[model samples]
Target: MEFKLEEFTLGPSIDTLKKCKKADLVVIAESFDVDVPVNINKQGLMELLIDKLTEKGLFKEPAPAVEAELGALAGTPAPLQALPTQTGMSAEELKLTLRIREVEVRNRELEVEAMHLRLKAIEMERGAAVAASPSATQSPSQSPHDSFDVSRHIALVPPFRESEVDSYFNAFERIAATLKWPKNVWSLLLQCKLVGKAQEVCTSLSIEDSLKYDVIKATVLRAYQLVPEAYRQKFRKCEKTATQTYGEFAREKGALFDKWCQACKVETFDGLRELLLMEEFKNQLPDKIVIYLNEQKVVTIADAAVLADEFTLTHVSVFSSPVRREPVSTDRRVRSPNGARRNVTASASARETRECFYCHEQGHLIGACPTLKRKGQIKQTKTPAPINLIQIQPLSDKSTKVVESKKAQIDSVFRPFISDGSCSIVGNEKSVPITILRDTGAMQSLIRGSVLPFSAQSYCGTDVLVWGVKMSVIRAPLHLVQIRSQFVSGEFQIAVRPELP
Candidate 1:
């Protein structure tokens, strides 16, 4: 749409109309920024504008060729024949088709990739049947894992989904890395054998012997759990048998441990002896020859609790009883049929030599080392500021010199206070502190009191009233009755009822 801008000057009236026609008016059409009102019938304004434009001869007039084209558009070309390709088959159209083909090819590729990923996931779940061979290259069909008839493989653990296995494998891989074992756990194929090897490996590791033992123990247990059910019992039994008590086998090997214990230089060798008595340690023992020669009584719960609170020996819990499951009588009764008499070694070859933390170690507690101790070396001693100390004087000491002067002030302040004689004071081993009331005005003396021991308040009514109040037989006459403080805790007395004034 094109526009022209027009400017005009208007005359005032009919008299100036003649001049308006003769006036110089610049007229040009200009485009106006207008949006047609939507959701309303603005077609009426358009119709009126069209008529105006037609009267002004500014409406577009159809050329003969345009009229012919419009007539042809009304009916000439068949729908199929009028398709885009009918226009001489342009290269742009061919390019669009090729682009569509590319999209289809990409979709097919994605489908294939999706299948491959799916298969990989299945392998991870069921434990990937990886084709690892001594040869540089091996076919997937000939893979050791594939040849591993999963049916033949013992089911050590319950079956899990692909995703679950994937998650487990991820964690397994991480632990395997730190333990620095070969990355591929083909041992998983030989689950029981793998666990057995794990125990050996952990035992063999030179670094952090205790920690290594724990790792190997944990790893072996975990691996055992993953073995097929057929292999599990056999594996456990064999593994456990392999880990048989030292008392059963390796008698000669026991000698070395005994020698080592001697060098440890334990104070009494009592603690070391008790350690040998442990079933687990015995099972792992070098031999039966190393039975505890002299053992001390094992620590009790109280002892273990103290140990835990003071140190980080978390293997034992103080709160629970130390479990000593004595192997049943059957094992003991099943002795050698030959009935050969065994000679008791005359004495232990142990001599206290090297210092262990438990024995001669200085400056450090058992299980704690100097390297681990945190240091805060700056030490300063400062005298403590005085505290607000208050001391009570004996009730007998009327002239007690109070360390704090406020005591004298308090005594003077309470001097005028009158008593209604309704309270009592009681004492255990100590006498009750008394404040004497001075009301010397009346002929009858007034006494106000509460029971010395609140607990004996009932007794004041019963025991005291019956017996009458007595202070070492210096009984005051039937005096004013103070229901509150009648009992002198030191004396057994009955309350004296006095006549009301």
Candidate 2:
């Protein structure tokens, strides 16, 4: 179905205008007698004709592509594709298909770019969080060259002692290098703070502004110089037991020897192994075991330590078996064959006749006697004397007068601060008397729940000090109430530890 160039004088219908291609639009423009650019592109020509046809009220805008697809699917030919001939229709269809595919590819590219950006944002957030964490920040905060404070750093470093002087000097030398202090002042500073006998050699110099670091160091070291015999004597004297582990004993002996070497300026490893081995064998094991090792000639402390541990475990097992053994009663009420009970009291009496040599008492041997321990404890001076609340124990009738006089003397000379008080506790039903001690050195307050008439399980080996003597106490929870007076009170919580003494 073809049409002539001069088919209609007025512009074509809206449907015909919508269906016309750029070539058809250019032909229509020429037919309408309107001036068109000689070099105008197809798209420009199409737009110009659409404007001219719309100005003349002969055409309307085409429907969207989606509506066009729906219209085509419903068996109606779209307005934009209503041309009779199909010569350039395939090219237009190909261009529209390529444009839609290009749009889909562009959307996919945008989505991938957005995903990458989101992942980067998440990584950046995690990095920031890790940097903000305490563990991650700790190392950076500890950069010595940046935040070093000499007095503060040295304050944490303990005081120099003879035993640890070598390590101390080595560490301080590094710190001095970092601080950029003069090398000449190093030994002089150390000499001034000398811990042991090293100071004795540098005493009373009387020289001002002329003492050299090397000279001071040499003099102190000379004083520390000792012979191999001295080292042997000191090392051999050291001992360890099953109660003390090999590590602890080694540390103690090492410190002692180090101190000795520092004082003598004498570092000798001679006979050291023999001394340590012998000491370990003698002290860690029993006498019989020590003799056996001496016969075998054990040379290493490690071997001796192992043998000693085995011996200790064996002895413990042997001793513990007796407790598990059933006690056999020596009762003399056994029935004889003639139906008469024969008394075995004489045999029991003869067995009980053994006496303790230490206490000279009957009915017990020296090994099983309890009196020897009491005697030794009485002689020991390490035990702290109990502080007496009252000086004298008077008769009942005269006790009041003596107490009054003692109280007067106490009030006048030695006034004691009483810690016990009665206060109402929060979350409790009644006011109770509590012993409150003011320990200025303590980090937290404690209370005894046993004083509250409640069940508080004991935590054994929980040590505390009472009147300067170390004692064990039990832990519990305490609801504290501070009473300023009879009318005013304040409630608070505190950790409770029972039986302060």
Candidate 3:
């Protein structure tokens, strides 16, 4: 534990302090006139001793012999003769302890290196500020490049990342400005840090163009597809990620928008407004419409609007209904049996004047009158002979064939209703067997009260049109009825008629 004062004029090295026990550390501390706190641990005591000794200019650099020994220990196992015997520790234990301490020392060295780098960065920043200031003085012979250390300044910049090329360049530019790095050497510094695709892009350029930082940066960005269109697309499609906060997403979107604006060279308010309006217009349009506009290479808003309107008009015409027209009469006059000329409009006038004899309705004959039919008062009537009727010739074979074909077409178009099935209506004390007609087109089912075996009590009366004849019918609540082998239990309308047709 005792150290000779002459040999220890410069205090023991960190390695030597690490190897010593607590008692040895205390002895070393005393020799250096360093205070030893009673509560201090071995590690703390060593640090205190080292600090005090170094402050007093007593710290010593490791001797050549110690350096050689450390190198040997790191590369190969230590010899038994070199292991300390006074510590009462085995050779293996001491070697393990030394290896662990070596790791700890390496870690501390890394930490110290980081601290030095940070301090160097701070100094560079200060120097840059002073050089930029108007009040600062410098000799005419001295150049700004004299203090510009490319290697050191480059070390402060992060490596180029393919995925984050924009961000990496942003950081590079900031650091270069703070360190007062010469613009002429920016491309060289950037070239050194390029990796992956960025490196490929830089290497692909000619040496002359490669020397220009702008050229190199533009090439790199273009190679990565970070153009104005790309930025705009990213801004439009950027959605908030689950892991990202709203603030982060907003800032990211803003950054992308700025990059897009810069890339597009939108400097003035008008240019920015036009660009924004165009993008918003495209976004608001349907995907198909947007694609159509893109395919047509529409540049102006007016052109897009015109094309959209044309497309809409064309499609609307395709699906629109055709206009219908009333048939025009070609006949102007008719010839009578005596060769007297008569007007065709006179017959139309006679038909307009004609009225139903039963109900006095102008539009229909007595046979077709709905009131007479609904009242069951319709009767067959003979047609009176005309005072001045034209003698009509027999029908032509062609005309008779045309009439028969028309009648057949009418029969084919209108489906005749047939009795679907038989059903029995059960009343208070009686049941009636009736034919069932299933009219899918009819909204409500109606039963003739004249056909019912028992009397039906009318509840609420409603007007129903049967066979183009309006008639009053009442809703009759039937308890149960069997139809088509199925029991139907619901309300049924009972039409009060004289008899079933």
Please name the candidate that would achieve the greatest lDDT relative to the true structure: 3
Write the number of the candidate with greater TM-score, choosing between 2 and 3: 3
Question: What is the C-alpha lDDT profile of model 3 across 1-501, one tens digit per residue?
Answer: 553322232223566667778887775665445788889998899888878867853343333434345546344323233422335757787567566556644654464455556657878999989888843566776645566677677677687788898778888999889877789888888899898888987888998898899999999998999977689889988987534567999999999999898877888887787777767677655455666776786545777889977876776633232334443323454344334554432133433567889888786556457897767643543222111111111122355575345435433323253232333453343443343444455444545544544332233323433332233332333223333423353434433333333
Per-prediction TM-score: 0.13, 0.22, 0.29
Which pairs in model 3 have colliding backbones?
11-58
Model 2 misses residue 144 by how many Å? Answer: 32
Ranking by TM-score: 3, 2, 1
Q: Please give, for residues 398-457, the per-residue lDDT of candidate 2 as tens digits.
A: 355664554455443334432334544444556554434344454444555544433222
Local distance difference test, candidate 2: 0.51
Tell me how candidate 1 scores on lDDT.
0.34
TM-score for candidate 2, residues paired by index: 0.22
Q: Candidate 1 or 3, higher lDDT?
A: 3
**Error in Å for residue 391 of model 3:** 96
**Which parts of model 1 have CA positions greater than 4 angstroms off?**
1-70, 73-501
